[model samples]
Target: GPDLLTFGEALVSLRSAGPLTAGGALTPHLAGAEANVAIGLARLGHRAAFAGRVSDDELGTFLLRQLRAEGVDVTHVVRDPGRPAGLMFLERRTADLTRVLYQRAGSAGSALGVDDLRPALAAGARVLHLTGITPALSAGAREAAGWAAETAARAGTLVCLDVNHRSKLWSRDAARAVLTPLAGHASVVVASDDELDLVGAPGADEETLVTGLLARGVSTVLVKRGGEGARAYTADGRRDAAALPVTAVDTVGAGDAFTAGYLSGHLDGLDLAGRLRRAVTLGAFAVAGHGDWETLPRRDELSLLDSRQPGDTL
Candidate 1:
């Protein structure tokens, strides 16, 4: 059994050099929020497992092989032959901006149901990680996400929820309705600074939102500020970490990488400040490269970034 368990949708990502309408070369990559974090944790030498459904196709086979190569436990992943695999297109709009388009309406990943979550697997793990995107997939997936959170909570496993809101999948009201209740079962809630309101109250200020979340039984609230940095709020106090000064190429998947680092530090029994430092460090590594999880550092290689100066060869 793994120490950390995460479940969600996994997609076959196609990267385009420019706009999708411009017609260019497409490069294939394995991508999913939960899978990315699982890979990141595995790279850091953690026992991480990913559970989801992938189509029984070549793309699904490639995804499973890639995750196995990264040392992530995929024993609970299902291969559904009825539905096709989901696909997401990443369009590099400019040097710094990237646009994502999803074609996953009725895919296999969206068909994740309550039975997909193995109670033993969920209960055995020390932490169960989930994201808001899973609930937005479909009614069945939403039920699965909620059931996982409730089960993990009852089993004394920490429920970590990342409010990864996807506007393309659903509306604000719908997202708030689902994510707000999901946060109730979460011990730790990670969200972008702007996304705080989704789990808290709409139009509430940062302080008010964070305070409300803490008051409602959330032990920790982590606010991710992309370039500015990240902040952690708790009953004790708040800790902040500035974003590392690194030239970012692709900003996608950086948040998932950060979540992985934070959870890794927690599993290692690090202090709040130490966890924040590791979180930002992993985030820097993600943005400093091209693909999502390709540039994530191993456990021993974590210090490599700190040892080298900008533009210096190791």
Candidate 2:
């Protein structure tokens, strides 16, 4: 029914407007790995749907409106009758350092279960996007993610898994155990170099790490190197793209933006090199923005980062 179907936790992000010590106020925005990807794909002109649970509260209403404003279909989103929506707070101490705090334990999103996977919501999408963070939420959420992946795999839909490990949720060992098999089932696996350890390859070089994931049956392994840019490995060959030079305002959600760019390219039938370039470009856009998904580019706005002539105007 949609081009992309994503399932995960969408939370209210209360990020500090300035340094936490000298904070004037905390700005609220929507934040989630899968949600960010859904918004990014929608921005790029794809029909994307997000399925998740939120509390029937003001925060939940805000989240729904934000997703809808981004053109993401929230038809499958459920509202928890009792528990409130989850919350995440970010405090930036410096340009390169940000501390994240979560108020999500026992929240509605953490309570996601296998029953949440309605067949109609999971089926017929060109791609099913998931994240390791969901499985780390709880046993039920883990089962739900696995069920979604298996269902997508059966339908020959590409299952994209992003290994977004959070130490606060589970141990590295536990994450490795649960995420390794899930990665094997994913057609495409995205992970940061540091996060690769969650899939059992801590401290391994990019090539070694990608090789390990490829052996697990993943068709493509995208190694996100933060400021260094990203590298893609596939059965046919590998391609790398250097990060663009941009003054980053915030680094959060850049990886999700990168994943969206790659997926967009995949859907558009771009070559490996072209895909990597698009991924890096989108990532650069994220870091240069003030909020997570605020600066993600649409197809036409992609050239915003390109050098402009002195007199150029719309």
Candidate 3:
């Protein structure tokens, strides 16, 4: 049994060097919010497992092999012959911006359901990490996300929910309806500053939203502020950490990296300040390179960001 478990739609990403209209070359990479977190934790030396569905095609095989090579357990992943795997194209339109186009409707990953979650698997892990993107995949996937969280909570496994809302998948209203209740089962909730309301009151202020979640039994609430850094609120107190000053080449997976770092810190029994520091450190690594999990730091490489000079080499 792994220490941390996560499940969602795994994707084959095609990254374009320029606009799609100026098609030259497409670089392939494995991607998924939950899978990215699993890889991040694995890179940091944690036992992480990922459960989901993928097509029985070569792309699916590639995804599985990539995850296995990263030390993430893929025993629960199903290879469906009837459906194709999901795909997303990352168009690097400019130096500071990247546009994503999705073509994942009716994909195999979105076919995830309650039956895919094994009770014993959920019970065995110390933490079950979920994200808002899973529930947005389909009705069956949504039900599976809720069931996994509830089952994990009942088994005394900590449930960590990352409200990684995607406007491209579902509307805000629809997302709130599903994610709010799902959050109830979570011991820890991670969301961006704008996404806080999805798991909280729609129009509530920041403090009010955080307080409301805490009052409703959520043990820890983490709000990610992108370039502004992040904040963690708990019964003990609130802690804030500034984002590392790094030139971001791609900001796609920074949040998942942060979540992985925070969860890793918690598993290591680190204090709140220590957790926030590690979270931001991992986030900096993610944005400092291309692809989703490609630039994630290993456990030993965590302090390199703090000590490296502009031209310093190890």
* TM-score per candidate: 0.97, 0.94, 0.98
What shift in Å separates residue 10 of candidate 2 from its native position after superposition?
A: 0.3
Q: Top lDDT: which candidate number?
A: 3
Model 2 spans with C-alpha error above 4 angstroms: 19-24, 94-96, 120-122, 201-205, 309-314
Residue-level lDDT tens digits of model 2 in 162-239: 999888889888899899888877999998878876766656677777777788788998989999998788987787
Per-prediction backbone clash count: 0, 0, 0
> What is the lDDT for 102 in model 2?
93
What is residue 44's positional error in candidate 2, in angstroms? 0.8
lDDT of 1: 0.91
Q: Write the per-residue lDDT of candidate 1 for residues 1-314, one digit (tens) a residue.
A: 68899999888999998878989899999999999999999999899999999999998898899999999998899999999889999988776678999999999999999988875354479889999999999999999999999988988898999999899999888999899989999999999988999997899999999898898889999999998889999999888899988888888899999999999999999999999999999999999999999999998888777756778986
lDDT of 3 by residue, 24-96 (tens): 9998899999999999999999999999999999999999999999999998898899999899999989867
Model 2 TM-score, 2 decimals: 0.94
Superposed Cα deviation of residue 312, candidate 1 (Å): 0.9
lDDT of 1 at 33: 95
Clashing pairs in 2: none
